[model samples]
Target: MDQSMASDLIGDLISCGNIDHAMVDGNKRPFICLELEDVSGNKLRNITLWSDYAQQLNDALGDRQNLGHVVIILQFMKHKIYKRKPAVSSMFGVTKLFINADIPDTHTFTKLLIENRGSEGDDHHVTHLTTFSSYSIKNDFLNNLQKVTINDIRDIVKPMSCVVVATVKKIEREADWWYLACVKCNHAAKQESVSEKDEYGVVVKKRSIFRCTNK
Candidate 1:
């Protein structure tokens, strides 16, 4: 959808980033920044939920862990031009929010999300209980990609994980298949070459490096 839509934005959408929590320095008000993306994994970065609306959805989600399976519906969003680029933001208290609510739209989207993973999603008890484990893995896949295909592995891409269904046709054993992962997390560690130079610009020592940007 265009960021500069004249009407509200209601779609099969999900959050693309961690819910941010911080206090506005001036007034010291809590606010959340919900990074949004459509069902096709297209990011809607221009869509900004204002502090009021952001707080509304943040409170509705309850346990932040439920973010993985949430499908957000914004009833009446607004559009504007910020910094010369088209942008969207909430209309103060006018916009309505829904997260995995038991409405027809939510049910339809929940069904689609589950089927994308080749699974039956019609668990009456689970659905009624709102235990949307049905979309956790599938939505994680949607988080990074619009579709899942084992063939996409050959394409040079950023390091990320997604759920995919594929037959284990063959295992290549000619070389090492294991890789080094971060001890603190499951993320694969990236290797880099490091070189140290003497004060006179002479090469002294070399080493392989692994570092975290956010650390």
Candidate 2:
């Protein structure tokens, strides 16, 4: 499919994934390995980039510290997994994932700021203006902030859309599932249930409730 067509179908085609690893090979090629799950939650998928595509992703990463919000177009091909806990080769099908790493303009940022500022207490408001503002600042400023605080900021900013910013404080892994803690209450809420297990053979039990920590 054409890039524009792919962009239009992103909501339906591309699934959201967590960045399990971002590695740069000896050749200095950047690769983003994602742990993506579909709506059905059938299995976790891996997405990878090779050659020049790697360089592009690396450049984009340099522009933005986090890849959670950045949108990219990917052409996927299915591959069979013969073993459980499949390796990267098994998880990521052979496909071309394309990305256009252009930063949002000032006007777009301003609109996001206004929308988030207006929806201060609304549950539906999910934009993280504060973190966006912080990210917009120079790296030197980020250096001054504590590592924990920076992680907190990124967590808050990553999953948010243009309209809403969902800040995740703590994550709990339960029997084959994962839950995110409420930013307001720090309470664990069931987000997703997975079938993966730890090395110790313990079934992870994820929490189902999340509340704002402020309350």
Candidate 3:
């Protein structure tokens, strides 16, 4: 079946998986590794794209410049533990189906979000919908304007990762740490620490520090 046509089957289609590692086989064919999750909070899914579909996806994701809406149709296979964490395995993936989707004209979606802000029904629906809409607008703006690099896009969309874009007004560097000031809020606790690199070339880092612009 055409994956794009199955878009509606994908429930709560809000986010797209980030392509972390992609490899081509000895036959010069491509395969992709994607990190995906659903609204259930059950667990994150690791999807593998195989064969020709894989090659097509790899090319489509080249440079990752196009932050278009992705509609993926996947079938759950089994569960495996990698790094001692439970992960669902998936197959048959697609990407960049809507590279040409007009995102700037998101007024209707914005209106829907505003109308649902005070909704008292399912909180899960409300939260996911609002988040999806916000991210969609942000992605559209960033991609269409070509203001951010692929790494920036990955950072913004990574699972459970928070991203904020603002002008840096000031920086404070200490012996072991550094802090950034929020141009709008002037918050002081928005600090980040630098990690020491090990001799083996491994660097361990913590989650991103919180910063409130209060704008």
lDDT of 1 by residue, 1-215 (tens): 46555455544334433344444455553334454544454656555665676666657666544234566777777777765777766665677877667898877866776666444423311111211233375676667666746676658377676656667988998989887777776557777889999999988999999864325
Counting clashing residue pairs in each candidate, in order, gives 0, 16, 0
TM-score of each prediction: 0.42, 0.26, 0.27
Q: Which candidate leads the pack in TM-score?
A: 1
For model 1, how many clashes? Answer: 0
Candidate number achieving the greatest lDDT relative to the actual structure: 1
> Which regions of candidate 3 deviate over 4 angstroms?
1-30, 37-45, 90-215
Candidate 1 residue spans exceeding 4 A from truth? 1-6, 10-30, 119-215
Q: Give the Å shift of residue 21 in candidate 3.
A: 8.8
Using TM-score as the yardstick, the better of models 1 and 3 is 1
lDDT of 3 by residue, 1-215 (tens): 22323221121223333333333354443344544323342323334445554555556555554333333344443445554654433344433222223454233333343355443223322111122223476677667754565467655543443345777787767565646667665555454565656788678654556556443
lDDT of the structure predicted as candidate 3? 0.41
Worst 10 residues of 2 by lDDT: 4-13
Model 2 agreement with the true structure over 108-194: per-residue lDDT tens digits: 433453464453222321122122223345664556644444345546644433222359887767565645677665556544445
Residue 74's lDDT in candidate 3? 43
Clashing pairs in 3: none
**Residue 158 in candidate 1 has what lDDT?**
75
> Lowest lDDT 10-mer window, candidate 1?
123-132
Ten residues in a row with the worst lDDT in model 3?
Answer: 124-133
